[model samples]
Structure formats: structure tokens, C-alpha cells
Target: MSFLDKMFASIGIGAAKVDTILANDRLVAGDEVNGRIVIQGGKIDQDVDDIYLKVMTSYEQEIDDKKVHKECVVGKFRLTERFTIKAKEKREVPFSFELPIDTPISYGKTRVWVETGLDIKNAIDPSDRDYIEVHPSPLMSKVFNAVTDLGFRLREVECEAAPFHARRRLPFVQEFEFVPTKGEFRGRLDELEIIFLETNRNYLELLIQVDRKARSIGGLLSEMLNLDETNLRLTITNDNAHNIKDMLYQVIKKYS
Candidate 1:
């Protein structure tokens, strides 16, 4: 290539570009995502220090008392070590990694994606992105399904900024909100907001805040300010997964 061509390539113009190709974009948390990075060489050979991928998601973060969307890297992995890409050559590298058990599910207003970039010496790096649909783990789905079995309607689900009280691997947490339309909680509880702390092989942890409906003038004022709620801690095992409703009912009853 001509000197001019090399100079432009050094500045990232017409440089090697990368794209991630996943076997299947839709997957549940705790499952392995298999993909290959296809790198198409540009005008000149380039020495790459490394190629890496990051699992990213957007979260709500409060800044200056206002909420803003912030992109966060939930997990990362290096695809390869030092390598050289010959001019006009194309290369592919395969990779597989488990999505974190706590990875946020792709639901209303929530998104997940994989981003890839090359670490090159003395040259601008090239990057690519592939969005994915992440679903809940089997254990998490069972818990949510139990809520429905108990007649609680799934009202809303969203990725929210993690408050100080929430301890999580990511900066944000997803909350599933539900309202009991029929059952013991119908009149006593207004809604319940739950954050799945995590789901391990042995147990699942949940942080729940149950909101109560207003009874009188004083109660109404507290509800408006979001002050009338009961917080509960719950842990369920594989054994209890089958009877999650009963466990939830007992906990709600104690607060009710």
C-alpha cells in the first residue's frame, strides 16, 4: 500500500473491522453464548494486542437529582492474545462464555448487547456491536410464574438505578412489579416491587417491597409520598420452587 494509504489506516480509516456473530442471539441468563468474531483486514497489516468483548446493558442512574440512561459493562472476556492481521486477509475467532446469573432480562424498556473491540498498537481500534435478547433463568422464571399462579398480575418490569440498599454486581437492578387482582392480597396490598438479588444452585434471594393501599386521609398522604410499604427478605430453594406461592403468601400475610 502507498504511504498515504498507510497513514489513513493508522488513523483508523479503512482499518480492520470486526463483527460478532452469535449462534443464537436469544438466550437465558446462566446459559453460554457462543459466537465468532469475524475480522476483515483493511489496507495494511496491523498488530493487535488483543481482542475483547463486553456484555453491556443500559441502566437508570441519578445524576444531579435527575435520572439518566447509563450504559454499563456487566461482564467482559478477552477473545485472543497478540495477533497480526495481514492486509486484505479475513480471520475468525470463536468464543463462548456464560451470561451472568444476575444479568438483567430483556423486557419492557430493557436491552442487552455484546460489544467487541480490538486493541491495536499505534493505530485506532475498530469495534462492533451485536444486540441480544436475554431471558430469565429457569429458576427466576419459576418464581415469576408462581406469582401468576397466585393470581398476581404482572403490572410492570423495568431496569432501574440501584439504590444504596441494593447490593448487586451491576450498577442497576431490574424490578418486577405486580398487583394482586384476586386472592388474599387483593384488598390488603396495592402492589409489590421485587428485585431478584440472585439465583444460585442451592437458593434464590429476593428483595421485596410491598405497597399498601390507603385507608384514610393520613394513609393517603403517606401513600402519595411512597411511605407506606413493607420490606421483606425471602429465600427459596429448588424444593420450594414448586410451592413458591405458599411461601410468598405466608410472608405477605405476616406484613399484612
Candidate 2:
């Protein structure tokens, strides 16, 4: 290759590029993701130091009272170490990943994607992004459905910075917001927020934030002081998942 050619490749103008093709874009949490990454070589052979695939999602963060959206990596997979692709060569790498139980589901404004990159020595890395939809886990679906069964409608689902009280492995936590459409608790409660902290084969640890509707001057004062919001930690097990409606009702009742 000529000097100019080498310069162009080094700058990634004519360098090897990576593209990730997921077998399916829609998946449920706790399910397996299968995909193939295609690497296309340019005018000259390219030495790849490594290849990395990252699973990430977007979340909102508050900075100086201003909300900004940001991407958070949920998982990462390394595909290769010290590989080379000859001139005009094409290579495909197959992969499988088990989506974690706490993977954020596609709800409201939340979005997730897989990013593949070719790590080239002294060269700009070429990358590709493929978006995917993640649905609720069986356990999550059960609890969320119970809310609807209790006359509550799903209002919004979003990921935000985790509060200190809520221990989380990830920097951000997914919260499902709901409003009672018709029920005894309808007028008394303003909103209900549910955050799943962690889950296992036998149990699910969750955090709940209840916001009550202010009915008097004292209540309004408490609301402005952040006292009207109550946070609770609840652990539900496979044996008692059916009682989610009752459990949530009791919590709201207390705050109402």
C-alpha cells in the first residue's frame, strides 16, 4: 500500500469496519441473544487488536436541576484478541449472550442497542450499532400485570440515577410509574413508582416510592418538603408473587 493509502486506512477512511446483525431484535429479559458480527476489510489487510460488543441503554440524569439523557452500558462481550483480516476479506463471528434478569425493558422512552467495534492499533476504531427491544421478564410481567388487575394503568417507565437508599449494581435503575384509574385509592394517591433492584430464582428485591395527593395545607407543605413521598423496600418470592396486588394495595393504603 502507498503512504497515502496507509494514512487513509489509519484514519479509518478505507479501514476494516464491523457490523453487528442480531438474529432477532425483540427479546424478553433473562432470554438469550444470538447474533453475528460481520467484518469487512478495505483496500489493505488490517490487524485487529481486539473486538468488543457492548449492550447499552439510555437513561435520564439530573445535573444542576437539568435533566439530560445518557447512555449506560449494561453488559460487554469481547469477541476476539489479535486477529487479522486480509485485503478485501470478509469474516463473520457468531455470538450468544444471556440478557441479565435486570435488563431494562422497552417501555416509554427507554431504548437499548448492541454496539460492535474493531479495535485497531494506532487506527480509529470502526463501529456499528444495532438496536433491540427488551420485554419484561416472567416475574416482572406478573407483578406489573397485578397492578393493572387492581385498576391501575401503566403511566410511564424510565431509567434514572439510583438513589443512595436503593442499592443497585448498575448506575441507573428502571422505574415503572403507575396511576390508579379507578379504585378506592384513586383519589388518595398521586402516583406509584416501582423499581426492581435485583432478582434470583426464588426472590425479587424491589423498591417502591409512593406519592400521595395532598388534601390539606399541611399535606401540601409536606409535599413541597419531600415528606409526602414514602419509600419502601419489599422482597417478593415465587411463592407469593400472586399477592402483589394485595401487597401494593397495603403500601398505598398506608400512605393514602
Strongest candidate by lDDT: 1
TM-score for each model: 0.92, 0.94
Give, for candidate 2, the lowest lDDT window spanning 10 residues. Answer: 162-171
Taking the tens digit of each residue's C-alpha lDDT, what string does model 2 give over 1-256? 8888778999988888788889999998767899899999988888898888888898888999999998888888887778888888999999998876677889998898888888888889999999899887667888888778777889998999876766477888888999989878788888888888887556788788888989999999999998989999888888888887788778777766
| TM-score for predicted model 1 compared with the true structure | 0.92
- lDDT by residue for model 1 (1-256), tens: 7898788988999789898999999998878999899999998888899999998989887799999988999899987889999888999999999987778888878889999999988888898989999987667788888888777898888888877667577777898999989977788888888888877655789988889888889989989987889888898888778888788878777775
Best by TM-score: 2
Clashing pairs in 1: none
Clashes of each: 0, 0
lDDT, candidates in the order shown = 0.86, 0.85
